[model samples]
Target chain A: MSDSIAIELRDVVKRFGDVVAVDHVNLQIRDGEFFSLLGPSGCGKTSSLRMIAGFELPTSGSIIIHGREMGITPPHQRPVNTVFQSYALFPHMTVAQNVAFGLEMRKTPKNEIARRVQEALDLVRLSGLEERRPRQLSGGQQQRVALARALVNHPEVLLLDEPLGALDQKLRKEMQLELKSLQVRVGITFVFVTHDQEEALTMSDRIAVMNKGKILQVGTPTEIYERPNCRFVADFIGETNFIDGVVIGRDGNYTVLETPEGLRFRGLAARPLSDGTSVTYSIRPEKVRLLTPDGALPPDGLAGTVMSVNYIGSDTRITVRINDRRIIDVWEQNTRSTLDRNEYWQPGEAAVIVCPPDNALVLSE
Target chain B: MATLQQQQQGRDRIRLALLLTPGLLWLVLFFALPLVIIFVYSFMTNDALGRVVYQPTLDNYITVFTQSLYINAYWRSIWTSVLTTVICLLIGYPLAVFIARSPQQWRMPLLMLILIPFWTNFLVRIYAWQIILANNGIINGFLELIGVGRLPLLNNEGATLIGLIYGELPFMVLPLYAAIDRFDFTLMEAAADLGANKIQAFLRIMLPMTMPGIVAGSVLVFIPTLGQFVVSELLGGAKVDYLGNLIQRLFLRANPINWPLGSAMAVLMMIVLLVLIMLYFRATTEEER
Candidate 1:
């Protein structure tokens, strides 16, 4: 992807009567990048995408698509296409006809339209089913037709609104990879909107986490997952154990946090923190190492009792109760096939859960 | 247990037969029997004294085909019915779409308004139109007060058309509403997103999807208008003569009542209606398949 911006939203706001669906937001998506708007339902992600597609007029801001200001331009006038969540395939048209509809609307030469339609059908692996109506296809097939119909136009940008939400679990996984590869092949900017965090993390080059009509953070998958700037992003992206604390001191790049129980913890702060500032320290379950009580203890390790041990085939998820009130989960991967079943941690056993200071995140929101 | 299953199946068949018998018997007795009697009567001649004559002859059929008066009435009926159906479609389509796209609370009320005219007697409604379209009626008087001068407003083909369209509008709107209410509007947005303007999207998506409604509404309006007698009699006075009026005069008003000629004309009209209905079914079924 180039450094040139393909779409830029500047102070964009959209209100539907009494409800502000998209609050004032500013963003810039680079050319050919697979960007995602990740959030729960009704979080203004779809509204932002619709504004970019010109389906909606921004109440008080500007949307620039490839350097052109999209001010109240109708959807048909914009150089963008959308794959709707409902897979809005024209029922009266065949697969080829549906794909050719956009080109026909633009009044392209008949032969050229046919060629592009065939090419798009081949891209989605639906070449042989060109003569069939949308009703004759399965859910996955219909979605492919919707994709091809939009892609055949060779639009400047493509917007997908939870396009894989209706598919089965296995099919959704396959299509996530398929859609990512398709974006790469076409070399077009894809602004995908999805509520499924795993789907966003798996497919997007960059993700903008949003909630309540505002964008929380925008970064790569690992950056957003590992160095989340707020509690909502950390909690929404993955399972995290939060321990409330007050910053007592600063140790170079790390902050020393003291819990109410007089337990001290040290972690890297997402932003600069002053002494005595209230903060919440978060650590992913997989980042904490679980050890036996008799093992060599790290200086910063907290002694706790194992409350529950769940062996879920791939990993052994153990919840360790720290101090009197705080319970933290530790995940241990099943990397070996030892014959002894007793190798697993038993309930009520004393355990030491150590979270390396570097892996801990101090979010002050 | 096998015998019990068979007995249950037999009872189900008998139940189906009992449910269908009433409708089937009504059609065969009141509909099919009359049609057969009319067909037979069309070939028999009436005596000069208006007495019954069972002698079969082709003279009545020849007269029906060759007489200019009967032929002119048939053509006029066809032309007027076509005109009425077209106008009804033009007016009803937009109204049906408006009602279908209306808010949830207003849809039923709007549809109810379309059907309120049916609660009153059909002939009474026709008479109401007669009073409204009369030369010295309320509309003409209002026009004169507005300085537009009194115009010839009634007892003409135009007045007959207005009455026919008003009476048949509800039939057209109901079927169109039913079809349009179930339409998927999201497809229109998809069209617009793919680079189609408002008019193109409507033509390419909405119109094709609602074809069934158009066909149904047109057929409903066309069939009844073809045989409409009261609208012409009340609005056209004695100046207009439609197939229905002609048939009524033949069987009931003519001296020594020409039942044979009336039966022949009725059979010919039935043939025309049957052909039109069959064409409609064929066209719709082809599209569905």
Candidate 2:
């Protein structure tokens, strides 16, 4: 990705009657970046994508594409194309005609339109079925046609609204990788909107996590998953065990937090927090290690009893009860090929849960 | 003993036949029988007293093909029907789109407004149009009040067209509304995202997608308008003869009711409409390939 921005949303606020769908969202998408607006349904992710596509004009604030103010500039006049979630391929037109629609609209030369249409179909690997109508094609094929139709226009940015959402799980995964590679090959900025966090994580170069019409955080997938700045982002992106506590003081680079029960824990903080500030200490299950409690307890270790042990295929997940009111989950990878009953943690077993301060985060409540 | 499955299949067949008996009987009795009678009548001879003779002849068909009166009526009927269909489509397409695109709460009321006219009798509504279009009617009265003087609002082909359009508009709108309602409007956005302006998007996407509705509305309006004599009689002052007026005269009002000639004319009209409708569906659906 280049330093130049492909699209920018400046305090964009979109209201549908009384409901604010996108509230004061500000974002700068760099050129050639695979950026994703990730959120749950009705979190305004799709609404934000629609605003960038010029489908919905912002009720207030401004949108700029390539430094051009897109105020009241209709979708057609803008230099961007969209791949709709429905695929929206014209049922009456054949695959070739559907792909050529944009070029025809622009009044491109007939021969050139044909050539580009063929190239686009080939790009999506749909060259042999040009004469077939959209209905004649399978769901995956139709999705490719929708992609080709938009890409044939060679717009500055391609906006996709859950384009792979209609596909089955296996096909969805395949398309996610294919779409990511296609973006790299084409080198056009992509603004993808999806509710599926895994899909966003797998494809997006940077993700903007949104909720309740506001953007909670925008960062790289690693940053979003490992160092989520807020509690919602940390919870929404992946599963994490949250322990409510108050900050004590800093120990080297880690911030020390004390629970209501006076159990002390250390974690990294995205921003500096004053002493005595209430916060939630979050740590992923995979990041915590479980010991048999037969040796001397580490300084950050908590003695607990194993509540339940679920031996899923790759990992053995154990719920360790630290106190009467609190339980923390720990996942240990089954590195050994043996299936001996004694190898896995059993219920009622005494265990020590040790969480590394580097892998843990102190998120504001 | 027969297998249980075979016995069940036999019983199912008998039940299916019993269920289909009434509908089949109705079609054979009222529809197919009349069509057969008309075909036979068209090939029979009619005596001077207008009584059908047993002798088979093609004279009725020949007369229908050669006579200027019959030819003129056919042309006039076809022309008026085409005009009515076109007018209905021009008005109804937008109206249906408007209703279909309306807010969820408003759509039902708007659709109800289109259909509320059907609560009254068709003839009663046509008569109301006559009252409104007549020279001394509400329109002319308003014109005179505005000091524009009374214009010739009725007793003309224009008035007949107005009446026909008024009667057939709902037919057009209903089917178009159904098609537009079923249409995924996201396609319009897709088209626009592909650099098509509003007009281009509509022409390339919306119009073609909603074409099934257009074809249905046209047929619904055109077929009825072609056979209609009531509107022309009341609104056109019976100044010009249409196919329906001619057929009515031959069957019920002429000096010697010519049944064979009327049957031949009716059969010819049916053939023409069938061919026209087939061609229309073909032409509209050809682009789907």
Per-candidate TM equals: 0.95, 0.96
Candidate 1, residue A15: CA error in Å?
Answer: 1.0
Report the lDDT tens digits of candidate 2 across residue range A5-96. 99999999999889999999999999999999999899999988898888889998899999999999999989999999999999888889
Best of the candidates, TM-score = 2
> What is the per-residue lDDT of model 1 for residues A165-228, given as tens digits with 9 covering 90 to 100?
9999999999999999999999999999999999999999999999989999999999999999
What's the TM for model 1?
A: 0.95
Summarize candidate 2's per-residue lDDT along B1-289 as a digit string, tens digits: 9999999999999999999999999999999999999999999987889898888999999998899999999999999999899989999999999999898999999999999999999889878888898789999999999999999988899989998998889999999999999999999999888888889889889998899999999999999889889989988889999999988888888878888999999999999899989999999987665
**Candidate 2, which segments miss by more than 4 Å at Cα?**
B1-13
Model 1 misplaced regions, further than 4 Å: A295-297, B1-9, B49-52, B280-289
The superposed Cα distance between candidate 1 and the true structure at residue A174, in angstroms, equals 0.7
List TM-score (chain A only) for every prediction.
0.98, 0.98
